[model samples]
Target chain A: MNVFVIGLGLIGGSMALDIKTSNKEANIVGFDANEAHMEEAVSIGFIDRKGTLEDAKEADVVIVSIPVNVSLEVIPKVLDIVKDDTLVFDVGSTKANICTALENHPKRRNFLAAHPIAGTEFSGPKAAIRGLYTGKTNIVCEVEKTAFKLQERGFKIFNDLGMRIRYMDPKAHDKHIAYVSHLSHISSFMLGKTVIEKEKNERDIFDMAGSGFESTVRLAKSSPAMWSPIFEQNKENVIETLEEYIANLQKFKELMQQDDYNAIYKEMADTNRIKEILKGISIKTS
Target chain B: MNVFVIGLGLIGGSMALDIKTSNKEANIVGFDANEAHMEEAVSIGFIDRKGTLEDAKEADVVIVSIPVNVSLEVIPKVLDIVKDDTLVFDVGSTKANICTALENHPKRRNFLAAHPIAGTEFSGPKAAIRGLYTGKTNIVCEVEKTAFKLQERGFKIFNDLGMRIRYMDPKAHDKHIAYVSHLSHISSFMLGKTVIEKEKNERDIFDMAGSGFESTVRLAKSSPAMWSPIFEQNKENVIETLEEYIANLQKFKELMQQDDYNAIYKEMADTNRIKEILKGISIKTS
Candidate 1:
């Protein structure tokens, strides 16, 4: 199969690597708005060659793995140019906006909207690594809207990549992703900001911070070029999660003010359930 | 050296493991206020044998690695009982309060106040792992207060464990640790509490959260029994850092409320300096 991948950043570049691994004959072509990223992907052997919009349109399969807002503009164009037999899909984080943009498109049936629940804080073609998608969840929203043949091909591709397939409504995907994914990044961003702003000695924070701080602040290193627009496109749900987060922080702060060690202990102990939750997460991801 | 380790949890047990590896002839005896923790340490080979208060006073070296608040009560007693030849030290997070407790004690010269800037979110004897302290920073607080001979031995032991040592005053250690270490834990804990409270489906959160969420919320899995008292013992500094953290959250929230994507982008980009800072950190620790 000849596949053309748009936006050869972390996700697209990673999937390109996996696709080549799964099927040796799969020819993967990469394209990115940042020509440098596309060149890096090819030079690093993440893809067979670089391609154009026309090249993508004519390929056996087209996968758009660009940022969410970029997807709104580019995915529909890809759909317009795609051949009758082409299988198209996107691996965007937010789903509703892109799904809405394509609702009435004549080739809507050729496109599958997916959110692969896999990524790291790092970004760009340089951040690509092998086995990024294996055993992770692949969420396909509005699956029924995509043509039956497209859906079957999409499922087969994801399964070949060793991804667990899940079907969900577009709105539910956005709402849940806001809580599970976007909010975590925002929380980490704020944490890094607060520390950098408050701690006069950056060297000290670095020296004294343990692996726990490293883990908690890791997401702060994510690409702003990538994320700011995500929060913008998914404004309603992201803000709601942020507000709930602030409320919780305030409550915890009040408990600190009251010197309520008992309540603080109970709250933290309750949250330790995340240990079990993360254990479950690692098993699935592992 | 016959070393008596009080409070055989993560730090103590880990240090004991390194002590054994570094000096096979060194007899590492364990004593914990928690009898089960003591038994578990011995059973798991974290120590040579369980010991009593007499054994601690008789040992050539004594290490206290209990929770911060308990250290206040136990440390002074250990100081009172230490023989003139015993070199005693602590691995508590907060140093000021413990230093204050030892200020007028006659055995102060024998006690070196230390905080090994190393730990994971998990706790207990089971959490002890070999090489846990390797390539990590060990902050020696009020080094001048320890007898010259004891200070040299303390630095030598930490060096033998593959740790880089830094010296600072007790007050500064507490204040800086509040921002770098304690505050990170609170941010993570509140994040977990907020998600656990707001997101209705625990299973869904577990299923959907990516490695980013796992990293950001990892500290929420830490033992409250360990942290709440660190917050209490260093109440003033912890509260100040928390206030600054809250203020940062509010500023970010206001930006989101105004839909200021530009400011959001700039703020996160600024905080992304943490990437370089963490790079420097790994270089120092590695």
Candidate 2:
């Protein structure tokens, strides 16, 4: 099986590693616009060989794992070249634009719009690790748009990689993910911005940071090249989440000014239910 | 050595566990406002025995680990009963209010204002774990106000627990903590509130949540009983931090509205420096 992975970074590199391990016969051909990343992925042994975009024509399966902005630019080109029987899937964060872009493509049946809800704060080929998608949720948007055989092939790979699949409409996936995923990255990045600005004068301010601060700001370390395009593609939904988040902070501040600690306590206690909600996500995936 | 832990929650209970392990001759006496917690701490083996407020006079060291609002209420009572040579230190999040309240106490020298920067989102006796303070920072405020002998004794305990100590003025500690610790909690709680509120209508919204959302919102699961008082005491600084945080979010949102992807990318790239900052904190503490 010739499995070609495009854009060799954290997601692409990790997927190649896992697929290589699960399918003994899988030949992992890797490509990235950044030649350094392609070489690093090869040296790291996640890539069996380096391939060009033109070589995607020989792939039995092609994994599109580039930034969403780049996905818009390169995916149509890949679709223009791949054979009819080739199964192609993308793991971008935003889905609506990509799904709509390929809607009228002649080889649309060969492409699958997927978002595997898995990542770390780090990026690049060096950040790749085994079992990156294990016990994680892989959301598939517009599953019906892909050919039946290709869908079956993708599911087999997802199962081999230990991912639980959830199907949803592309628009709904973008809106809901704006709340769950995109808003988290924005909030974390801005929190880091706020604290870093303050740290300018107070050199020891971070000395007092605890695990709480570290956990909340961890996502601020994510790749800007990857996230900026996501925020661009889901502009409306991301802005909406930010508005609601900022309003909540303002209201919390107002409660503090009013000396209504009981209200503040009630609000925190109410949000504590997120523990149960997150626990469900873990159990459902694991 | 008799170490009496009042308010047997995460901090106090974990301290008792580590102190017991590190100092073989030390006796751990636990007390809580709630009788069940006191009994549970005894059963968990972190607390060697149950005691009362009056029993503090027999203690060589007293650890005040209750909420900040409750600290202002109960700390004076503990100070009044402790022996002149006994060291009484607090592990509350807010330091200024408690230090101010005890500014002129007859036994002020016996009270040490300390905030151990160690904890998990979980609370109570059951959440107690060994080595919680190991390699974590412990902020000591107004150390000069503590008697030389008591300060020596407190430092000895901190050493035994393997904690790194940093000294700061109570006011400065509260102000810096507002940016690092308190503000992160508010951002996380608000983020959790925003997402959970949306989840009310979209029952499966959480299914789309990934590790990014989980990490950013983890602090929202903190005990309200523990946090409300910290906010109430650090209200002014917390509100200031919130204003800065909200302003940053609004600015980012405006950039999105203007389709200024380059500016957004710049902001994220700048905040990426926090990775280096946080790395320094981890290395300093560890």
Candidate 3:
């Protein structure tokens, strides 16, 4: 099989590596608007060749792993060029915009909207790793809209990469992802900004940062190019989550300001139930 | 040397294990309000035997690692019982209250107020690990209040645990830690609660929780018992930090609600400087 991965950055480069690792015969070609990323991807052997949109015409699969904004802009172009039977899919963080963008495309049947719920804080071709998707969940939205053969091909690729699959409506997928993923990025970035602004001494952050701060702030290190678009595309849902998050923080602040130890204790205890909820999600700490 | 560790849960238990790991001949004993924890500490080899406050009176070093509120209540009592030469120290998250509680004690000179900036989400004896303090910072507050000989002993133990030391006033330590650590716990807990409330389907959280959510919400898994009192003691500082944090989130939310894409992009782009701040903290993501 020939796989053409556009945007040879972290997710795209990682997918290229994993596909080749799973199938030795798989020929992977990569494309990136960033010349430096393309060079790094090729030098790191993430792709067998550097390819173009013209290459999509011959690909058995075309994976769009660019930023959410770029993915929305590029999906129609990919659908226009790829073979009718080619399994074209996007691994964008937010799905609704891309799904809506391609809803009326003539070759919409060739496209599958997928989001493999996996990533690290790092980005770019250098951040690519082979087994990132293994043991992770892959959410596919509006699967029925895609042709059966393309859906089958997409599932096979996800399965080959050791991911569990689930289906959801595109709108629902974006809403939930805003809470589970997008909000996290915002919280982390804001936290990092808050601490940096308050503590002008960078050495203090370095000396005092424990694993708690590291884990909580990890997504603060994600690429601005990738994340700024995700926050922009999923603006409504992100706004809702942020409002609730801010309200929650404000309530806790009020309790603290009033020296309401009982209320503060109860608030923390109530939220501490996340231990059980997160355990259900396989986020085992011990 | 004889070492008596009060409150043998995660932090104290890990301290015992680390001391033993570094010096096999150091006889370590433990005391805890929970009998099960005392037994678990002994069985896990975190301590040679379970002892009492009376044991602290005779030990060369007395370490109190109870909840912040409990530490404030117990430090003066423990100081009254300990040998005059014993190096008494408490490892509570908040320091100001404990320092104030023991300020007028006859044996106050022996009491060292220290907060080790290290921990995991897990709690209890089973969560104890041998090298938890390695490469972490141990902040010693109000060092001048401790006798020179006792401070020397405290320094030796932290150095043996492979921890760097920093000195600060108790007031400053409480305020700084409220921003860096206490506020993080509250943010994580609230984020978890907001997501749980929004996503009524527990399965969706399980299915969609990627590394981003896992990292951002990890501290929500911390023990409520351990954290509740820290918030209670550091209430003012926590309230102040939370106010600023909520204000920032609210501003971002309003921007998103107004569909100000450029404003949203700029907000994220500005906050993305957290990458540089975190890098300064030596948090290597890739």
Candidate 4:
């Protein structure tokens, strides 16, 4: 079984590691634009060898895990070279554009649009770890477009990697992801910016910051290289979530200004139900 | 050592647990407006017994850990009854209001204004855990107002509990805390509100939510009873931080609307410095 992993970063490297673990005969080939990352992935023993896009021709499976913008240009070319019977998938955050771009492709049946929603604030080949997808949700968009045999192949890999699968249309995936994922990144970035601006004047302000502040601002440390494209691809939905978030913040400030402690207290108390809503979901924080 | 813990919640109860661990001769007398909490604290072995306000006369140390509004009312009476040798301190989030309210009290020398920057999202006696303050910063405000002997006594307890002490003025503490602590709470609460509102129209929104969203919204689970008073007392500084935060959000939204991906990328890349700022600080997520 020949598996070619493009963009040997967190997601791709991790997927290769897990696939190697599950299938003893699997040969993992890594291709990253960064020469250092491909070398690191091989040195780290996650990838069996470093290969070029030309090597993807013989692959039984090819996984594309680059930034969304780069994936837009690279995935169609990957599809252009892979065998008819080969299973190919791209694990990018935004799926609508890639799915729409590949709608009329000759090998469309061989391609699957998947988003394994699992990651840390860190990135790169060294950031990859085994079992990264375990117990995480993998939203597969436009599954109907993929061939039945390839869908089975993708599900086999997802199951072996210990991920729960949810299917949705590509457009709906982008809209919903804006609320749950993209908006949080924007919120964290702005919070970090606001505090950094104030920290210039007040040097010791961080001494007063507790675990709560740390938790709320953790996403501010995510890689801009991976996230900027996601926000761009999902601009309309991201903008909508940001507007709603800003309005909610303004309303809270108004309540405080009016000395309406009752409303302020009630607002937080209402949001406290998030504890119950988020109950079985465990977030790893190191 | 007759140590009276005036509230059997997360902070006070945890303090009692640690103090008793350090001082074998110490007797922890628990008191809470909630009778169930005092009883539970005693039964849980964090406190040796339940006590009333009259017991404060015999207290060698009084640790006040209640809502700031309640502390304003109860702390004065605790000082009036405590012995001249007793060390009385309140561990609330806001400092300036309580410090000013007791500025000219007859027994002001017996009081030390301190804010221990530690806690999880949970509350109550059941939420109490050992070593909650270990390796955490304890900001002591208005230390000069307290008697030199009482300040030494307070420092001894902080040292025994493995806490790092930093002296700060009450007004400065409040203002800085608004940026690092209060503002983050407002952001988390508003994020949770925005998502919950959207969840009304889209039921499966949270299904796509990952660890990033979970971490960013964790503070929304905090107790409103405790936070409302902190925000009210620190209103002016809190309002300032909110305005700055809202402006930053608006600016980010404008950049998105203008389709300036370069600026968006730079904004997040700049804020990634938070990883360095928070390197040695560990926040307990579970």
In terms of DockQ, the best-performing candidate is: 2
Checking candidate 4 for backbone clashes, the offending pairs are none
Ranking by DockQ: 2, 1, 4, 3
The TM-score, computed over Cα atoms with residue i paired to residue i, of candidate 3 is 0.95
DockQ scores of the candidates: 0.79, 0.87, 0.62, 0.75
Clashes of each: 0, 0, 0, 0
Q: Could you give candidate 4's per-residue lDDT for residues A1-286 as a string of tens digits?
A: 8899999988998898899899989988989999999889999999999999897899989999999999998888889999998999999999899999999989899999999989988899999999888989999998988999999998999999999999999999999999888999999999999999988887867767778888899999999999999999999999999999999999999999999999999999999988976774664211
lDDT of model 1 at position B205: 55
Residue pairs with colliding backbones in model 3 are none
TM-score list, all predictions: 0.97, 0.99, 0.95, 0.98
DockQ score of the complex predicted as candidate 4: 0.75
lDDT of 2 by residue, B1-286 (tens): 9999999988899999889888999988888999999889989999899998888989999999998898898999988888889999999899999999999999999999999998999999999998888889899999999999999999999998989899999999989999999999999999999998998888799888888888899999999999999999998999999999999999999999999999999999999998998897678556
* lDDT (Cα, tens digit) per residue for candidate 3, span A1-286: 9899998887888888889888898999888988888888889998988877788998999989988898877889888988879999999888888888988999999999999888888889999998888888888999999999788888988989988888888888888888888899889878877777787753464466677877788887778788778878888888888888888888777777777778767776777777766776674212
RMSD of each: 1.4, 1.0, 2.3, 1.7
lDDT of 3 by residue, B156-180 (tens): 9999988888898889888888778
Highest TM-score against the true fold, candidate? 2
How far residue A20's Cα lies from its native spot in candidate 3, in Å, is 1.3
Interface RMSD of 1: 1.1
In candidate 3, chain A reaches a TM of 0.96
Task: Estimate the lDDT of model 4.
Answer: 0.91
Supply fnat for every model shown: 0.79, 0.89, 0.69, 0.82
Q: Judged by lDDT relative to the true structure, which candidate is superior, 2 or 3? A: 2
Poorest lDDT segment (10 consecutive residues) of candidate 3 chain A = A277-286
